[model samples]
Each structure stands twice: as structure tokens, then as C-alpha cells.
Target: MSKKNKDIEVRIEETNRTIKGTNYVINQLSIGKKLVGEVMTLGAKEHEAFLGDEDLGSYKSVDLAIEAILLQHNLHD
Candidate 1:
């Protein structure tokens, strides 16, 4: 892990809205003060499973992906 990873906390926020007459929840994630990303929930079970992860459950959206990418890059704090 690199210093950058240790300094960052990734958070995901869920938001719901209608697009083209369809309702969808968007997962918006913030990483420290640097990066942001989004993810889409396909089903309740899937979302719940995702939320079950100890390290990532609290993150609402793209935080998981961002964390994975950062970890892969060894960008730890």
C-alpha cells in the first residue's frame, strides 16, 4: 500500500431518479478529495451482497471499484 491509499476514504452515496420513465438508483462515490465514480444497482439481492462486504458495504456506489483500482495500483496511504 502506498501513502495515497492510506490518505483516502472512499464513500458511496445512493440517489434515485427517473430516466426515460424508468426509476433507477445511482451510486455516487467519493474518494478522499481526489476521485469520484458511479455504479448502478441491478437487483436488491445484488445490492445487499455488495453492502455485506466489511470494507465496502458502507460505500453506496463507485467506491468499491475505486478502492479496488487504487489497491491494484498500490496507492495506499
Candidate 2:
């Protein structure tokens, strides 16, 4: 099932910065005013989700990552 952006307010911000020699595109995920998690760009259409310091695993798309975040956090509609 696909999640619709109806009841929840989701936000994704890209942190364009390179650490060491790797180009890190950290997308900060938030709900309302509270930060829920982050999605790190692994490659083209590949992303890794994290809640705080715990790795949530890799996803095929950003939407999948966000869905995982919502499910894990019990915030899905």
C-alpha cells in the first residue's frame, strides 16, 4: 500500500556536504516540528533510513524510506 500525504506533515531536507572523500546527501526527515529520522543517499534511487543512531536499512526509493520511518515510529495513517 502507498502512503498518502493527507494527515501527516512530512519534511525532507538535503544536507549537501561531503565528509572525507564521500559525497553525503543526508536528507533530514521530520514530522511537524519534530525530527523523526534521516535518509542517506547511497546511490541513484538508493537510500538508507535511520532513526537517531540506529540504521533502519536500505530502501529503493525515498517514499519507501519514509514509509518505513512512519511504520517504525507508529505515525502512519
Best by TM-score: 2
Model 2 bad stretches (over 4 Å): 1-6, 75-77
Q: Candidate 1 lDDT, tens digit per residue, 1-77? A: 65553554766677896879988776655566544444555455333112212233333334454455445335443
What tens digits encode model 2's per-residue C-alpha lDDT throughout 1-77?
99776887778888976878888888898889989888888888899999878789999998899788878877533
User: Global CA lDDT of candidate 1, please?
Assistant: 0.49
Query: How far is 13's C-alpha from truth in model 1 (Å)?
Result: 0.6
lDDT of 1 at 43: 54
TM-scores of the candidates are 0.46, 0.75
Q: Which ten residues in a row have the lowest lDDT in candidate 1?
A: 47-56
